[model samples]
Target: MSERMTTATGTRDFLLPDLGEGLSEAEIVEWRVAVGDVVTVDQTVVEVETAKAVVDVPCPYAGRVVALHGAAGEVRPVGQPLITIASLEGGGDDPHATYREEERAGSGNVLIGYGTGHGGSGRRRRRPRLALAAEPTAATADPTPAATATPTTGGATGADGGARTAPLVISPIVRRLARERGLDLAALHGTGPGGVIRRADVEAASAAPAAKLAAVPDSPAAHVGLAPAADGDVVIPLTGIRKAIADKLSRSRREIPEVTIWVDVDATGLLATRAAINAATPDAPVSILALLARICLSGLRRYPQLNAHVDTEGQRIVQSAGVHLGIAAQTDRGLVVPVLRDAQQLTTRELAATLAETTAAARAGTLPPARLTGGTFTLNNYGVFGVDGSTPIINHPEAALLGVGRIVDKPWVVDGQLAVRKVTQLSLTFDHRVCDGGVAGGFLRHVADCVEQPALLVANV
Candidate 1:
């Protein structure tokens, strides 16, 4: 005798939510569940790497996991059904009804309620895949022992029982040489501690190929031969933050007519003011950038038009009631401009602390979505890199971006006498659509005046 079992009639599909960072897609780094694993709402089921950092994707449905559409290293488009969950027997009306019932009871998890319902029209648009072409192998490959690198404990492993090791843990300078010469990671024996790879090993391996190739003397006609056609172009697929940056920059450049104004001032008083402020408050020290940030905020307060953004769709100018100064931070990944809200209200010390916190978070790839958005103006410090002055590109949705150049000691005539003075350059790029040449010039002058005479900021405030 055989017993018949009724199959579940409905299945719930869990789609990816907009990770709250304006990211369109993410690459699946790892999966924590299998086909038969049971998952609860808000339980982390997978790890995804977005443009910013690695984020854990939580399960939106509570049931038996049916399937996973993509594997690790595959980039999944946003709003695509990633996993399917089969409703448990006696599990209420819908399989993904965890938060709905909770909401009815007036209590629910914060993020669980933000999940999208199952079985809706896919909101993600599929991007065209780029073809991966195999190039011919170069001759004179270095003869080195090929060893099966094993991953250390706590490191991620592959499915073949073979341990997965990090791609040669070497310094940046060494990595550059290894990449330029096409050296294999497994071939080089590391001289560093605990068999860890070193830069010298990579350099030695890289130099071997060049030395072998350099022996062959080139003929006079060979030098005349059509200069090795621009070492083949590389096509990089634009997605996520890079794609967004390109689109935004293009839109801003095309739509917004920009005018730039520059000014040079003696920032000696500004440095002294910062030192005094920092000396008074040991707990909260003011940075040079923070002092400039405060001056910029004060100048923006005096000239509110500088904090305005052009509304293309609305065909009008949108002015911000509050000053949200965006500090441009350069990270290994890319440039991220995190906003400091209510910049005008914060004192020099508070501004410095917030800037330090936000910039650190930005570099660590931990800046929240709210902190990265809604900036009214921007301050870009090219001076740190020894750059004298540069016309910085205006951060989109913001009317103006102020560029701060390096402060240097230069001879200047004060009261008809040549004296060494600490001078710095300031450049302001404003949207001509919202701000005219005079307004932009006035704004730059105002900022320069505040920096030149730090006491003026207090008077203006």
Candidate 2:
């Protein structure tokens, strides 16, 4: 045979970038392109939700997507191959191959001020070689490198005398965990990022016998959320929305210095305004969330200082010109905050329509990435859940978040007279680094004033 094509060949694997967030891993929440699909450089190939935020990962090489290494909803580790791009034409060698390599090297250069610089090595660090090869049996034993291969139902050779068993496939994260726990992959059932055996699955399988026995009535394990005679271990995987929530909250807690202020307000006028708006627009029913969103937008306009975000790069606060209000919606998957762009420009009816559309999309898991970004402020309505008050966390990249509490009849002094007025609690949490207590208090008062006297907002309109 003539010389086989080597680097001259068109196919190249695209590894998952660090996304510049300094995170070692990310969950591939969505795949925008598939195998055999034509993709251009810089085109969004996958949507990955990092611990910090949801980011659209662009393709490094422009070519036909030959294969996707992992399935969607799988968590791929950093620097691992995610996609394979093959050149459209095959020949002795492509002239632009070197340029493609350079681009691949630069693919980790994400502009979002998130991802760290790509390390020099193209391949991930290999695992240490196993020492002793332990034969697979009913007995649990540490496996050696040579003993890594387990015999399936088929023998070493098939009926036709070909190699019988397929190689075991596992994800990088699973492999790392397996190495850490000294887990024998052959013995564990995979229930993780791909069919890769996770740590929890291994632990569960190991505890299964005891769990089954404990299922009997009056077992101590059963009384304490475990199996009856045995303790049933409950395993919850950190993936998708739940994973995102954990990551975001963790980052906010670690990075930002947060302070919260609470104020009780008369919500009678706000409720009336919402009812009037809904009656006026029968096609779109206005919700208390929309009303709170409008009040936040108005408050942001009055106190523009609160409408700013801390720029980590510049080490300064950048105030936004307009308001993009994010509404925290509880979905089956988890919590999603969808933004209503230019909330300052939208009328009550328009705001209601937009909120309805976004919430529906969030619930249906069909929200576009664009609609989920660029939020200057966020509103979490604990009121719907009958919560009177809650100190909400600030959505990072935004200065503040407003929590709207349930409205209830409570006695208050109105003009020095005891009266039962419809009251609601407003909790405002801000980044102490960028916002002072006075500014936060003023912003909260402004929102409360708008809510207590809906006429004030109408006057501006």
Candidate 3:
């Protein structure tokens, strides 16, 4: 959901509302409504992809569509105008005047952080009423002139030579590029839809001087020492989730003094325990991951230091009051961590059900930004990838990550006799700054003890 701003005229500018987990920006995925369409409050107008999830952004104001900001694949910083709408009733002065009882089936607040608007069941379309009197300001617009989706255009209203408007730029990244290169955005004519400044526009501008320098012998461009792509090389520009993962992992590696400790645990008892529970209740089956999560929660209770964040600015370790367990699930886009809040408070059955729901949502790519962030610790089941072990990077600020490798039958010693048991490797990677090896080892061993002896869980109960 988004916030709205009032103008002297009937049109209101809808700022991209805060998609919480406190994300700063999101890329426009697609537009659900077009210009000339009528909308109700909480009606999803656009879908945006944050680093963590794809969220439906509902417009807070109920009105006729005037213009859309930013095209698909474009990233918009939070608080930037998302759309323009003209109120259909009440002279556009009061944004909520058009609300009807039937249109709102939901609690009126749907988007996790956007509390200003309620959800609507349907929207009615009418003949185009609002004129494209003003061209939607440039680069930030997210529609297409094409039929499939959003509006792509030239300028909207106030384009006359008499009135000066700020240059339209596609996204904050494009603006950042121009700033870093000291390229004046106003000087460049945007080639994107609606004459918005795009990244290419800035690159082309920056390359002009470099292009000239390249022609001169022994010029600075040649000595810049940048490598050129080979013929037939497929260059993939990092965007969206991949770029976010890179940034986070890069930050973690750069900031944390990390250490990984691992142990091979006999999971035969855990497997049998799962079978017994499922056999007793065939309708409600629990996953191994859920059990592992329960174990992690208990271990955190024993050693709270691992369930915490290092407040580097304050030089303090903030132990979380409750476990907000993050589960890493791989999707087509990338790895996403969907958090389960207050995980320690749930019973095994409750935890399993919620885990199933959360993981399913993650795989479907429908999790809201709020559900994707704010984890005290992360549990990664790299075992699904058929790997035996990994030195995983901690999910930044969080003190530790627990990784589970694939479970396989391996030879083992029990009661001084050779035996084959179901075994898995458990690895813990923690921030050394938070606690020493003793604390880390204690937590890891506690988790292993639970896995090796599922009956030990009764003690916690």
Prediction RMSDs, each to the true structure: 12.3, 13.8, 12.4
By lDDT: ranked, best first = 3, 1, 2
Stretches off by above 4 angstroms in model 3 are: 1-10, 87-109, 117-230
Best by lDDT: 3
> Across residues 354-458, which tens digit of lDDT does each residue of candidate 2 receive?
998888777644564556678998989988999999987788778899998889999988889999989999999999888789899989988888889999887
On a 0 to 100 scale, what is the lDDT of residue 389 in model 3?
100
Quantify all predictions' global Cα lDDT against the true fold. 0.68, 0.66, 0.76
lDDT of 1 by residue, 1-461 (tens): 00112255456667767776567788775576778776655455676766655565655456677788797546898878777877666645644456434323322222212333333233321211111111112222211111212223335454466765555442332333344445545556677655656666766666675544322123332222123345664344464456667887887787778878898899998989888877887688889999889888878887899898887788999899999999998864468899999898887778888999999877655555667788999999999899999987788889999999999999988889999999999999998888678778888898999888888888977
Cα lDDT tens digits, model 3, 52-153, are 766667665667898999876678999899899986865445544655343345325456545543544454322111112332222222222121123334
TM-score of 3: 0.70
Weakest 10 consecutive residues, lDDT, candidate 3?
A: 124-133
TM-score of each: 0.71, 0.59, 0.70
Ranking by TM-score: 1, 3, 2
